[model samples]
Target: MMLDADQRRTFAALADVLIPASGPMPSATAAGVPDALLDQALGYRPDLAELFAEAVARCTGKDPEAALDTLAAQQPEQFQALTLLTAGAYFLSPRTKAALAYDPPPRSALDDVDSYIDMLSTVVDRGFAIR
Candidate 1:
């Protein structure tokens, strides 16, 4: 999924509003929340692309915060969904993680343990079956 240049700028502006720069955390745009990332995360949902486009159009030439507030009031679900998607994309960026000093745990080598346990349970259940 990709956004045209104009849409990317608009989405970046929206992301800036959704996540402003703070002491440690950079704004969403600075954290590398590009429209392509957003599109990839959100494009699967039906009508979300249209809703985001409409919201961006309506927000143009307006104060981003005010526009977000109005959009949130008028379309809470869309606003929330966009917020979640934007945050998810933003936090996934290495810049954001570095800013926040967040180091995710390494992939657990024991990940297969649960599957192994489940397989054993299935085998035991089958063995104990009356038939």
Candidate 2:
């Protein structure tokens, strides 16, 4: 999509913060960009690529500090939705090591289906953590 490089970087950084490095999975920076999925996203929703540049300008105070209050206050659903979307992309990315990463083993039976759903539940609980 032709977003400015700065915007792309901001979006990536935002994704990093939203998902962070929790549990066994690596941080977004460590995981790096999911090149294939990102390319797919760029091809599909070009405008979505600008979400960070658009949100951060007004959400973060005055452009220097890293905080998210007014933005969440104003956008609410949009803010959390952006976090979920990017986090989903990142979580599905190949960088996660033991937990989130999918390893195709030669077994017909599966395990931990409930845990998978629980992990998905975290998306429903988008608690603000800029504290």
Candidate 3:
């Protein structure tokens, strides 16, 4: 899942475009969206890595916004998937969270029984239950 230097630069460039710096908020790369983080975020979907790399390649030497627009028009699913992965990775950073004034609630041991039951009912209704 390691990215080479070129891939890393491409990812950084893409991330900066996706979450650009604004006022006090840092860009995605500035928020620590490195290749390692991207590797972990996208590891479960190796195909996405290749797709992103190809997309970024097409974006090389082009305006970031225009490149992204082209990618969105040409590969909407891949664009969405990559955008989600990049944003997820960026926001996972403590700096990004703090910048956004988001303080996630602490994990609790208690489970939501109603939600669990509702999920089970939905699964059963969809005929996914093991008979």
Candidate 4:
């Protein structure tokens, strides 16, 4: 997933908070749980993996879980921004409009989130540092 095992739960909690299901779509937590996606990205998208890793390292130093907690505590705004960034990545995927098994809300069959996530993921995967 996007986070390590321990980080998974924390990330999930954060995801749920940051991008909750509103009316018709799943929360970013469910939508962006990147087990396979993360694996693929880490292996295939070296740039993204490195960029994201840098962020993790900056926060946690080594532990992904600690990184998230630290990021939230030390840099709440950055943490929130990261959460939205991840959500955007998942939203931009082609499956946004596709029916989900456990659909949430706020979003309907608009295929909007899919696109958002896809684009966001691409932008950050390359490890672009935003100042």
Candidate 5:
């Protein structure tokens, strides 16, 4: 689901407040939190789409910081949705990832079953103690 222009502006404004530039880090907007990255983030978390949309709509035309404060205080669920999506999207940017020195873990699974065999055997020895 694409955000409308106003929603995009509002989201950008709010995201900047939530994740302003830090020492070595860029702000949310600089990291593309409200642009293509946002779409990618929503794609990763489709379950949060509705809540995120509602959050943007609710904050539209309001002062970004004040709106965030209100949402955090009086509408915690929406606030959580907004912050999660914003941060999620911010991290999706290559620039952001590089700035944070993020390294994605290997996709291949390691077969470590043998490493825990002794623990498994102990559990088996205990047997099933049904209450």
Candidate 6:
């Protein structure tokens, strides 16, 4: 589930429109949204591959902004897939994450059994019921 060269080019164009450079942030293409980063994103969410491909195909040879507007208006699902994949791929870039200061440290899960004791008791008392 990978984009062909033309599809990748179209996707890059559309992605740049959606996520252009701003302040310290790079545009989507600058962040590799259409290359390895995009491949990583598609690997992570394979469900989006088909719809994302359709979006790229639909927008081919059209004005990126106008195509996005039309897709958003007339084919919302495809637009959503395109936007999600574009943003997801852009954010997947190490450079993009660094620019946004979005490094999230791993945190250990907290044990909060005491806080849910009352709710757990109520549910336990109700027991399981089959319709």
Considering summed lDDT, which 10 consecutive residues are worst modelled in model 3? Answer: 35-44
Candidate 1, residues 5-100, lDDT tens digits: the string is 876777688889778999988888888787455755665554566666666677677777888899899987667766777887886787888887
Q: Against the correct fold, how does model 6 do in TM-score? A: 0.84
What stretches of model 4 exceed 4 Å from their correct place?
38-73, 92-95, 99-131
What is the lDDT ranking, best to worst?
Answer: 5, 6, 3, 1, 2, 4
Point out where model 2 deviates above 4 Å: 34-36, 42-53, 56-66, 101-131
lDDT of 5 by residue, 43-122 (tens): 99999999888888889999999999988898888899899999888878888878978778888687778869988898
Give the alpha carbon lDDT tens digit for every residue of 1-131 in model 6: 86789888898889989999999999998888899988898898999888888888999999999999999998899999989988888878888988988658988699788979988898889998887
- List where candidate 1 sits over 4 angstroms from the true fold: 43-47, 106-131
| Per-model TM-score versus the true fold | 0.67, 0.52, 0.71, 0.42, 0.84, 0.84
Superior by TM-score: candidate 3 or candidate 6: 6
> How do the residues 9-76 of candidate 4 rate in per-residue lDDT, one tens digit apiece?
54455555556676667665556544443444345444455445444446542454566778778866
Alpha carbon lDDT of residue 19, candidate 5? Answer: 97
RMSD of 6: 2.6
Error of 3 at 104 (Å): 3.4
User: What are the clashing pairs of model 1?
Assistant: none
* Number of the top lDDT candidate: 5
Among all windows of 10 consecutive residues in model 4, the one with the lowest summed lDDT is 33-42
Supply the TM-score for candidate 5. Answer: 0.84
C-alpha lDDT score of every prediction, in listed order = 0.75, 0.57, 0.78, 0.56, 0.90, 0.89
Model 3 lDDT, residue 102, Cα: 68
